[model samples]
Target chain A: MLKLRQGQAAIALVCVVLGFMLAVQFRTAQDIRSSIPFQRIEDLSQRLSQTEKERDVLLKQVYELRQTTGAESATKESENIKMGAGVVAVRGTGLSITIDDSKRLSKPGENPNLYLIHDEDMLKVINELWAAGAEAISINGQRLIATSEVRCAGPTLSVNNTRYSPPYEILVIGEPQTLENSLKMRGGVIETLQFWGIQVSLKKQDIVDVPAYKGAFRFEYAKPIKDGGK
Target chain B: MALPLVGLIIGISLGVFFPLTIPVEYAKFMSVALLASLDSVFGGLRAGAEEKFDNTVFITGFFTNALMAAGLVYIGEGLGIDLYYVALLAFGLRIFQNLAIIRRYFLRK
Candidate 1:
């Protein structure tokens, strides 16, 4: 009887762990249906086209607004600056750079972080691109702005407060050849990342469209100083 | 036996109502661990039916088997080979065999 009673403790403990594992698996599969699970690939492509159409309509409205508000001479210049700052989605012939975690298995003594891409890697690459005259940049649908912060969130990267994982796609709108060359220059960001076994690829494209910033901009302390009709 | 069954019921209910997420990397380890635990439980059941169940053996096997199986999977992942499938196949077969024995024991009565 004593032996039987003792065995029961083990039974209970094992069952609890088993139940927990099963539950976690169920939750993971449900959580990672990879977003828009209900929508097929065809539906997603169709949705993309719909969003593009909407953007066109908004652009026309902006153009009409500028024409009617002809009193403000600074409007056109501010609009151009807004587009360069990633407030508006901009399309141009530029470059696409993709950085992903190395698939190679780490050596027994190697630090796993060496093979993984970090937030600093992103900041470095973006900084280099900007220096090369990238008009606008977006990483994994998270548009880069003056306030955008590239940070490490556990095993993932967070850009502008949105979390993303490896294989980060960076779309830049500028001179494609110049941007690509700057990134791949000897002793540059590409070589530095490659030294850590990080997979980096720069591809020049005929057209690269960058998404607009999706985050709200809050400025409490830095109030705009108006020239007041200079 | 009653206490253990009650504990199991409580566990499953808690798990169902309050499921938690683990890291994606640990999924394989969790699977193999669960399989190993199931194997131990069934073995214990078989031993009890045959009047040879040992508490020490059951409890030690319960913890060690799960951990060892999970460790093998972790190692295999590092080595670029999946060891969980092997553990799964082996544990799955043993679980069914032990279950069959327990079923037959009840049928004999």
Candidate 2:
């Protein structure tokens, strides 16, 4: 009884504060309930716009690439492009290269074959020239296409299924300096071929002629899948 | 007890009608402090029932306990730990114990 008499005022004051807290908490909870749905809608709309912006950027990139090649808008131009794909003769500023047998005779008891350029050697040169941004390449007079074949035939080399004896003249149409530098860079294809004692020469020209690919193309198994846009 | 009940009713009505704008960040602090305050009120009730309540102790404990609980929550938030759970569990347990003692006081045989 004495304790209650002394503590009554403080106890009432403390209870009032507690009750006030409870009421505020109740109102805050109600506010949270109303705000949650709005937050979710805001988040979803933000995601949708972000995805839409990404799609717009990709579509713009596709449009820019198509404009450069003129590949998508007109079918006749695209067909002409397909016809000219490593064929139908194209002329541009480029480099002319000649790779021949080594000046030295074959080593004692070593195969005479090792001193001559093989199909793989020619293939390596073609691949390197292409890597150096060569737009068109031909070995001797035979133009190289996607289906062109290079192989050994007795003492001669077969290109586009036609055999020709070297000194091989490879004509390439592209940025001549870049192509020449790519070859002349130490530890590259030209260096390796030179180390084998093979003779190699490169000349830049303002106008280089590459004959049309005369070989036939055969597609046996592959076909492009149709797109809805087409 | 009658005076406390009357004061609580008036406080609750004032809270409901006053429309005070407490910031969202302070909500966790307020909640933890409120839990500590609730524990103190229940403790006071239990102590009064047992004839051992002290005015000065109850008043000081009211403010100090609430502040300490809120400070603990703020520190825990800064340290990236959920230390409010410690205050919550401690106060929650004490409130229940006080309620049980207060109930026993009323139901004593």
Candidate 3:
């Protein structure tokens, strides 16, 4: 009976230790699943890849938007260039001037040529309008550009190589009051022309139209420098 | 038999209540120790059924086997060898053999 009782006590002690170790080992395995660095690293890598994909998609969209806006801006720039080159007709509030030869007979010893409107008089009037900030100008439907010419073609006046007899109509686009003041200033172009008995009339209009340059542009001697030049 | 079962239940509850934890690095040694203790328990049961149970042998074997298994695992890790597999195989076979013997003795009774 003593032997049996001793055996029972030993077995009971061993069983207690065995059960405690089993519980602890199970708990430790659970801890590893929750706290291990390898599992955490795997999760973080997955999130990083997802974020990178989203960034790449957004970058592609940005490039596409820039491409579209770039094309739109290019067209807008070319339109401005054409307007400044006098290749397009324009209209705005401005002044109109009509000038012709004097109808009165010349006095004795007076020069009759002074009573006629000369190309130099027209050039002086145009220059004054330009100085007063004319956006556009035309004479007898011929637009004035950088290459336009105004000179005496025999008895008639020539503008942009086209001849026109008086009375000449000059259309200018600008502030009407400013342009009128510029032309009518003391000892200005209009005052000089009126002293010679030349007929000159100035009128302010709500809208003045200037036609495009009709002459063709030929580049025979000049070429645009490549690579924006040195 | 009933007393040993009650002791086991008490031990599990105690382990559950305590918040003691081992380091992650020593987890392999703990597992080997656990296996060794389990093997000793079954060996003791078999000896008892055969009428040859010794309290001193049973208690000493329980502690020594657990310590030896843990030491073997530690040495295996330091040497970059898998010596724990040998301990595991030995313990697993012994547990089964002891279980079989206990089952036969109980069947005969």
Candidate 4:
């Protein structure tokens, strides 16, 4: 009887180990799925389109009202400036930074793929630029929003709808000096990228027009729950 | 002596089975529900086991630990953190509780 009980105990221990392992695997799978970026960008794009339409209609109404009332021209001009600042498309003062793989790091004996920039490298740059207070950013013409997913799609990184090869060029529109200084700030993005043998360049122009964000932001599959229960 | 052990086996089996179909978010909630149900069922088993069955104190101790599991799940969901951490907590606590029960049973004999 003691031998039988001991055998049962051993089987029970095996079950516990297997059960714990299965739970770990399931949790990891769920975490990776949640980290994917595409869904967030899609949601942000929808919001941008909605805000733009609302602003346009309101501006037209303000103009019509001013014309009939013959109010001070200063008031109209001020309104225009404020509205322009709010939804005004910016044109001028932009800097572009390009990242490419380092050729020096590659050799005949070692991996020839040494020059490729991984996803995390790009993410770091993007995060730094945002911290520098960049008003708008684009990667190869794909506009980035708050929810944009910057991830590796195979060999290329896809931002919004566009994908590009090595030597990714990221463009930002904001105050020229501030944007340039932001990139060059200590720790600093430029110094860090150079260490990795990635190319970093900053060019500031007077007429840099950051385009209004164009994307669809809607979540069809996700629903918020009050209390998490089965 | 055997009934409570069978109850535990049955409980753990249900834990493994119920989480298969649900999303990770709901699987977390179900984990808490399963532990709570196990506690209640074990309570009934302890009443019957009386003399031969042991480790009643350790089994009941699992209830206090269940709250910690439930708390971790709530914090994870509230913060939009991945559900894996919550699963980690639940599995860890269950294993600890099991060990405590086993230790009590063996030491008493």
Candidate 5:
């Protein structure tokens, strides 16, 4: 009986170690599955897709409204105002520009960030397009309006509060030949971008479509001042 | 037997309450160690049932086997040879054999 008791103590100690390890291993496996970075990425992608679906539905409604509205002079004037305000999608012969990060590897000791597309680079391209008389402009399907902003949100570009990853596709509605000449001019935006190994491709298409702005226009602070007696 | 079962429950609850976490990189090593310790426990149980339990041998074997299994995994990662499978297969086979022997010993008694 004494011998049995001694053996039982040894077995009990070993069992303790085994049980502890088993619990820890189970917890570790569960931790790996729900790691913070993995969960964050999944959540972000789900929100992105949801917002895109919502935009598509709103775009369909815009087209339906345009179709249902009769050809009266007042309705025609409102349609023109909507087009100018970038609230309605437009299609015309224009230029489609694609800008992406450089595929070329940087030399040792050089800054790798130079190869990436920056907010300023995109802003410069948009400014050039506007100067060349682009009637409408959209980047990665997000339209540019009077209140639209082009800013950097970490590694991604945020246009009008919506974030997009490269390669950025800019669609414009204008005279294709004129737009192309302005961008491809000597020592222009394209040449500057190419010098740092950034990839820029400009295509002159017969028809280019730019999506309308999907965000709301809030005027809570600034009431429109009457030019004269209303 | 009841004492060992109670010890196991205590150990599991202790681990749960400690809030300790190992990094993801060392998880593989922890798994190998867990397998080794499990195999040792069963081997010790079988020896005890057969009336041949040695305290020194049981304790040393438990530590040495767990450490060696973890070392093998580390070496395998360095050499890029995947020696983890070897340790796993050996320990797995031993656990089943020890369980069967313990079961037979109880049946005969």
Candidate 6:
């Protein structure tokens, strides 16, 4: 009985050791990796820039109401209504990228062969979306944050701990023309993915509303470790 | 297992006597194995002797590895030695520790 107890204790100890070592290693490594500009600052700056954009639809509506209403008593009332509705949160328009497995569109040396999306590919799209100045972005309804990490587990891509499969629809609500052009412009992501035989497409929508970040933005016990310079 | 133990001893000796001769890169990688093994063997011993392994000890072991790595880097900067080289020294020590565990406890299984 004593010997058996000792054996079990040894196994438990190994688990604890492995878990502790790996957790610390991962935490510190992630810190150093994120501190680099390519990871943290760039994404934050992009999100900030997107948030600060304000479209003065109210101003335009007021101008039109004034010209049409003429010198009427209700003209002021009409202007007020226009102003209220005009400030109704301006949303951007753009193409939504739906990445999925091309199980049906199989060819020579191409995508969907594994019937899955790789983490690197997801990273590419995320990076491109930021570059395109996407106002708001989400993947399958999960709002992305600065610390969000896309990691691969077997065939699935785990975003912030939630596993997602192919046909990963990335919705970006931004200026229709600018967003579409950004995705399809020369030397752009579409072309790069095209080479890999991955499907690339774009479509203009009347209104593309990308939702605000929904997940908790809680970060515990981690802060920037000095400026560290670029 | 014996060869790894011998390597660990050599690493410790070189670090103590002709520290400058040892390449920092090699030492850093070696440290990972050493530290990992030390973590494992001690873990097993604790389990064998004590009814349960202490969480505090395991956490501290991890913290020690991290501090050593970071401290070594800072020290290297001050001494005009490559920070990476200092990391290698820690790694070398870890390798020795790991070898000791593997030869005594791990291989016996």
* Candidate with maximal DockQ: 1
lDDT of each: 0.79, 0.81, 0.83, 0.58, 0.85, 0.55
Clashes of 6: 10
Give the lowest summed-lDDT range of ten residues in model 6 chain A. Answer: A82-91
Compose the digit string of candidate 3's lDDT tens values, residues B1-109.
7767887987898778779766555778999999999999888888887888898999999999999999998777656578999899999999999989888877776
Candidate 1 accuracy as lDDT:
0.79
Measured against the true structure, the TM-scores of the candidates, in listed sequence, are 0.52, 0.45, 0.46, 0.38, 0.46, 0.36
CA displacement after TM-score superposition, residue A78 of candidate 5 (Å): 2.1
Model 5: CA > 4 A from native: A1-74, A227-230, B1-109
Model 1 alpha-carbon drift over 4 Å, by segment? A1-6, A30-74, A77-82, A85-103, A106-135, A138-230
RMSD of candidate 1 to true structure, Å:
14.6
lDDT of 4 by residue, A72-107 (tens): 666876766643433344555678778877754443
Top of the candidates by TM-score: 1
**Best lDDT among the predictions, by candidate number:** 5
For candidate 1, write residues B62-106 as lDDT tens digits: 889999999999788768677878899999999999989888877
**In model 3, what is the error at residue A8, expressed in angstroms?**
99
Q: Fill in the DockQ of model 4.
A: 0.03
Worst 10 residues of 3 chain A by lDDT: A1-10
Ranking by TM-score: 1, 3, 5, 2, 4, 6
lDDT of 2 at B31: 92
Global local distance difference test of model 6: 0.55
Instruction: Tell me candidate 3's interface RMSD.
Output: 23.0
lDDT (tens digit, per residue) of candidate 6 on B1-109: 2332344455444434432321232334334533544544544444444445455664555457655665665556446566755555555665566446545554454
Task: Give lDDT for model 4.
Answer: 0.58
lDDT of 5 by residue, A156-228 (tens): 9999999999999999998788688667654468867887779999999998989989999999898877995
Instruction: Place model 6 in a CAPRI quality band.
Output: incorrect
Where model 3 places Cα greater than 4 Å from the true spot, the runs are A1-69, B1-109
Q: What is every candidate's alpha-carbon RMSD to the true fold?
A: 14.6, 26.0, 40.4, 18.6, 17.6, 22.1
